[model samples]
Target: MEKIILIGDSGHAKVIEDCIRSQGGSVIAKLDDRYQERFYEEHLIKGPIALIDDLLIDDVKIVISIGSNHIRKSIVERLNIADEKYATIIHNRAIVCNSVKVDYGTVIMPGVIVNADASIGCHSIINSNSVIEHDCVVENFTHISPGAILTGNVKVGQGSHVGAGATVIPGIDIGSWTTIGAGSSVISNIESNVTAVGIPAKVIKREGL
Candidate 1:
């Protein structure tokens, strides 16, 4: 069995734990910033996030199961581990095409569909029931939330978050560190570091505003 360590303990981490078990992997530890170093359960141990490097032993793989894109990026940078040490988790029920390329530390949840030629970058999340059409580019540290749809050729930049149930039209470009509001329809290009909401997904707020 593959030994793994999860870097979160929220509901998101719980789902990831199940996913790992489905692939016949064992999660030996779960690290979180909120918890002290101790056993949380008979089969689980909670540890401080700062001690991640020390806990990476016995060829155990790592996954940052946090739902927030910013938090995932920060944790990854702090760990500074090699690419091969990160785990790429794909739920057994996810329908990913053979032509698709998924980088390390990316998680593809159950009910996801990644069509041909799609590229998902490192530490990104393709959440449950999300549809990534052909030729889409989902960059590093991004999250395509549950039920979101990225139509063909959409390019979501690094650290972006496509909110749940949001739909982006074909050939759209969503910039880096941006957020698309839940259930919104993105009809045009979204700029970086902004929050876009509503039917047309306009930038309602920029970073620090």
Candidate 2:
């Protein structure tokens, strides 16, 4: 079994831990700068994020279990670990098609259905119960929150967050750093760095506006 070092100790980390276990991988240690306590009842609290610099041992993999897309991207950039050292975890319950491509540092949570020809970029999160349709492109550092549905050929840009239960119609393009609010029904293209919300999603605020 492969040994993994999980970087985060919150509720999100707990879910990632379970996904790793379900894949028959063992979590050797957990690192969190904020909470020094154990991850749960069984996993021990290893050390701080600073310890990552000293982890030069072979065969040990790392996974950023943080929920926030920005924070996860920052940590991954700071660590700069080798591509092979970063683990891509897909829960056993996920239904990923054979033609789907999941990049390194991405996590596909339980009940995720990634259809054919879908490309999920590095360090992205396909949260539990989400449905990513055929030919969809999810760029790096994006988070498709739980229960969100991306229809066929939908494009989610880098560093974006599609909130829980949101439904994006087919061929819609969501730009980078944009935030789609929970339960939104996105019909048209959403521009970069804005927050969109409504039955037919509309931009409520632009970044730094």
Top candidate on TM-score is 1
RMSD of each: 1.1, 2.0
Please, what is the whole-model Cα lDDT of each candidate in the order they appear? 0.93, 0.92
Model 2 CA deviation exceeding 4 Å by range = 35-45
Q: Which pairs of residues clash in candidate 2, taking residues 3 or more apart in a chain or in different chains?
A: none
Query: Candidate 2's error at 196, in angstroms?
Result: 0.3
User: What TM-score would each prediction reach against the true structure?
Assistant: 0.96, 0.95
Residue 154 of model 1: what lDDT?
A: 100
Model 1, position 3: C-alpha lDDT score: 85
Clashes, model 1? 0
Error of 2 at 7 (Å): 1.0
- Per-residue lDDT tens digits of candidate 2, residues 6-124? 89878998899899999999888788887553344465547778777666478889899998888998898888878889999999999999999999989999999999999999989
Q: Which ten residues in a row have the lowest lDDT in candidate 2?
A: 36-45
lDDT value, candidate 2, whole model? 0.92
